[model samples]
Target chain A: MSNFNLKVPTMASMMANGETPEILFWVGCAGSYDERAQRVTQAFAKILNHVGIKYAVLGTDESCTGDPAKRAGNEFLFQMQAMQAIETLNGYKVTKIVTACPHCFNTIKNEYPQLGGNYQVIHHTQLIADLVADGKLKTKDNKVFKGKRITYHDPCYLGRGNNVYEAPRFALEALDADLVELKRCKQNGLCCGAGGAQMFKEPEKGTKDINIERMEDVKESNASIVAVGCPFCMTMLSDGVKNIDNLSHTAVLDIAELTALSNNL
Target chain B: MAIIAQILFLLAFISAVTLFYKNFKKILRNIQLGKSISRNDNKKLRWLMVLKVAFGQSKLAAKPIAALMHFFIYAGFIIINIEVLEIIIDGLLGTHRIFLFLGGFYNFLIGSFEFLALLVLFAVFVFLARRLVLKLKRFSGAEMTAWPKKDATIILLTEVVLMFAFLIMNASDHQLQKLGQAHYPIAGWFPVSQYLQVVLPTSAQALVFLERFCWWLHIMGIFAFLNYLPYSKHLHIILAFPTTWYARLNNLATLDNMATVTNEVKAMLDTSLVPPTASENATFGANDVHALHQIQLLNAYTCTECGRCTEVCPANITGKLLSPRKIMMDTRDRLVEVGQNIDRNGNDYVDGKSLLGNYISYEEIWACTSCNACVQACPINIDPLSIIIDLRRYAVMEQSQAPNSLNNMFANIENNGAPWKYAAADRLNWANNLSN
Candidate 1:
């Protein structure tokens, strides 16, 4: 924390100072708990700080958004969890929210409206794209990813569910990498088999696992790096790449991480 | 003789109508078993949806050839029913060509009816060829086995025979009129039936009997077809309008929130609010037909069983056990079975079998990606995902029978306030040692 000089403020602390944040940074369960996804949460925070953006996390007040519970058919548990989060959010009168995870982004944007927690919910990539276009965050010259093949895997919740296909691409364009597309991309992209609360359960016995099949599409693209927008997609696709024969050569990075690295943050 | 004819007609009509009404009542009772929901909002949009989807048959345009063929049969069946009014009056009053008093207008109406009948007959043969001869992949599958296949064949054959009888009745009537027989009015032109006049027996007495036999058979066939609808997928003819009106008008991907759970959570958030006592309910999601919503019950009754939902399903394409068509069929079958059980034993009777395990396997429900492909593909807007999610709710909340990976995830969320095993204090570690 000393080396980074990151002045991360919680919503409670911000309220104590009588300062209201322009946006609430919702670091979802995956972003807060998963080690790989934690990197994404940090990368996004660094970008916000560098851009002089006003944002705060719920910190200790944060709880799971109950997306997995709802998707898994545990509506009782989901509501119990969602209501607590909504109460905390409404207490702060949060108007704008941005998250690095598509699962959280989707639930807050689409589902929370019905639960009376309506906010201007946005995925981090969409915010990043807006920031980049506004020239707030400058992209420094980086030789590492320049001309390197990177394929963007569309998260089911973000792409098909929400119809967000271009924001991540715009963020990736700032990296100056040769961005390719998997054949099954955009509206028709195959699930990484992580949506619908599948991340919490073992996949049923089948001839081929969904992730393994999706990895085959990635391998055919021959891109060394696969850019993802969702943490669940990152975990599943990372496992998928490892299961492939050429394990060491490929890397899976979140769009925020890619943005952070390219900007020398 | 006239009084005797009227008595026989009344008896046949009453019996057929009573049977139809009894079957309809059973269906209504079965649907009432579900929890009440209000799809009553958005009256204007609902009306528009019914007009476009149900009355317009707009979704059929996805397959142009099939749509054209289906339109012929659908229009023919509806238009031909207008003549039934004349048949009923003729049966009771012992008269022939009763509507012929309208002169040239009557001639045009009969002419159009005859044309549609021929088109309907031609379309039926085309449909038969598509199913039996062409062996379209969507028409034949695991769900298409036995009864479903036979059901399609039976409906097409019945329609063909009914149309043929109508033409035969007209041809013999025309022959009788040429001989200037009593009560056989000189009415209208029958282009196809006029050609059929040459094939009949020349004896006037024999012609009278043939004409009467064809007349009775045509009317009786119509009554029989009406009753057969409740047992076949052809129930779509009547149920389609209501089903379309109640379809989800929002984004196809949006899953509905369980209101009963949302209010409880709201109470938990504010301690001053009294959270409703958690009822020690037997199940969380749907365990039986009674667990579903009223609109869902309507959806089960409205399935055309054309297998369009199954055809577009990614799970089915990838060889998974999940078939949206099978899901709808199983719901209807279970509902019918439950209804019969109630009819036999009291309404409180329970069936040993249920939709979740007995009909739809857990493996099948878990296999769904919840892609909304099936819902989008359905012509009448039947949502299989809603049922799938409800059953999954039962599996996870009531039985706690979720896959092992899911249990671990739930525990992680409970302990760490996230879906991982790490503690909250360690959440900021990734931000450390950054160049910023």
Candidate 2:
């Protein structure tokens, strides 16, 4: 996977050259460390690079957006992390942010304004949709996923949480593939069981895991590829498919990965 | 005899209204027990939410069959009550069909009321069947066990009896008018209830007695139902409007930031800045009902107990102990208990129990994924997720108790700037082999 030499720019590197990128690519905690999620980060970064979009990653300067802490009821810790991230972002005079993680996208877009760190934050799917709409990213020649059955799982934070339901679907629609919808999609989408800090702790006693129940919807959809926009959903849905029987055919791919693969970026 | 009858009617009306007012005052006081938060901004948007959600029954559209049935009941409850005005005037003035002056318009009004009553009866039957026969999963939960279960049945049965009384009253009245009874007037039309005229006795005296009996039952039932609103989940009929109006306009992803915590953290970051002083016994989050915001208390009162929140809840669907409906029910129950405590002991007295552990168990609150499905499913915008977060706050901040895994995650966030324990310098390792 590392054989491909892709150009990735950092905010510090851009600053040293007296350059300001068009947007800041916020490679979130999952995108930075988690091996599986890092692929999504690279895929999205590949799309940005291919599109000739000037974007810079915060790299080591970026910290956790404190969504998990806030949701887990550690307000003090959340504010501490948020304040530090806000100060760093403000210091760089950053105004526009794009991230592959819905959790980071949501926390920055909605919750940051209250703490005096305001910016034009968008999910990477939204940015990708715009790029396709502007004709910067061409999907017309794409044949890799043209006839494949793809179902999109709406990430809770991106869909019901902030009403960004169409952007990801629009990106998937560009693949020229047979885009199917899960039984529970858009506003009524079910959780992938990795939210509210549940990703950190073991779920309380239950007859089944929430992800397994969501996987049932995926099974019902019968789509060969399950497209997700959030890193957390990617991990949860992947684990779900592996755990469930007769689901090995289903590949959980992020919207960015699908787009990048289809475009041969 | 007519004077005595009027006096009795006046006495009943005054007492029913007075008792309802007293109970309503107690509810207001109980809500006042909660901490204050400003939901007063954006008045125009708030009113729009009230109209769209409460009056329009917009959110109920998620389940079309249930929404249509509820619309029938809601419309019947509002429109049929106009006939009650005529009944009250007739009782006081010893007049028969005082609205007869409206001529054909009175007939049109009464006809519409009769039609609505029939629809209400049909809707009630369907609702009853859904609960008892069909056994909808949404209607059955651990919280819907005894009193909550009976409460729903009782309200439906009450509606059935009241609707029957209304129709029979119209039928007997129609029969009396045909007999040329002295006090009977040929006034309103009966469309649906006209069929019931066949059930009436032929004798004028018998018809008069039956008419009077049904009329009294219908009026008395309305009064009883009014007073029952305070104790029953039926209170949503009144509270839904205000609850929708005060709903959070912000995106569901935005959890409210604690200003006090921000101040404390600011002081920690900058030594020169002084943190705001807290009360001697200030708590981080809601351990008791009084610690919650007033709107959150209103949300408890407005919960219809339809179990829609619990039905859509991931935690509950996965067979976890957490049910969002139970959270609202427990909050209301605790508030009621605290209200009773205040009435028994003085206002300052504590019950030595709280909402967190006393009613909602740690296992239940801990199971939530905070996915906002429960929040989205609430028809009237009642926020069970907010209450769950507050309870979690009490557990984490006030008690310093959390799952061991969460403790490790928290430590990682503090030390490594991410939830996972990875060195900050290596965050860019994903881009190591990339070409510039």
What is the C-alpha lDDT profile of model 1 across B104-169, one tens digit per residue? 999888888999989999999999999999999999777778999999999999999899899989
> For this target, which candidate reaches the highest lDDT against the unseen true structure?
2
lDDT of each: 0.85, 0.92
As for candidate 1, its interface RMSD to one decimal place is 3.1
Clashing pairs in 1: A73-B393, A200-B405, A200-B406, A201-B406
Name the weakest run of 10 consecutive residues (lDDT summed) in model 1 chain B.
B275-284
**For residue B165, what is the lDDT in candidate 2?**
96
True contacts kept of each: 0.43, 0.81
How do the residues A59-177 of candidate 1 rate in per-residue lDDT, one tens digit apiece?
77888888887887777767767777888999999999999988788888888889888999999999999998898766546665888999999887888778889999998888888
Candidate 2 residue pairs in clash (backbone atoms < 3 Å): none
**lDDT value for model 2:** 0.92
Worst 10 residues of 2 chain B by lDDT: B274-283
Give the TM-score comparing model 2 with the true structure, all chains together.
Answer: 0.99
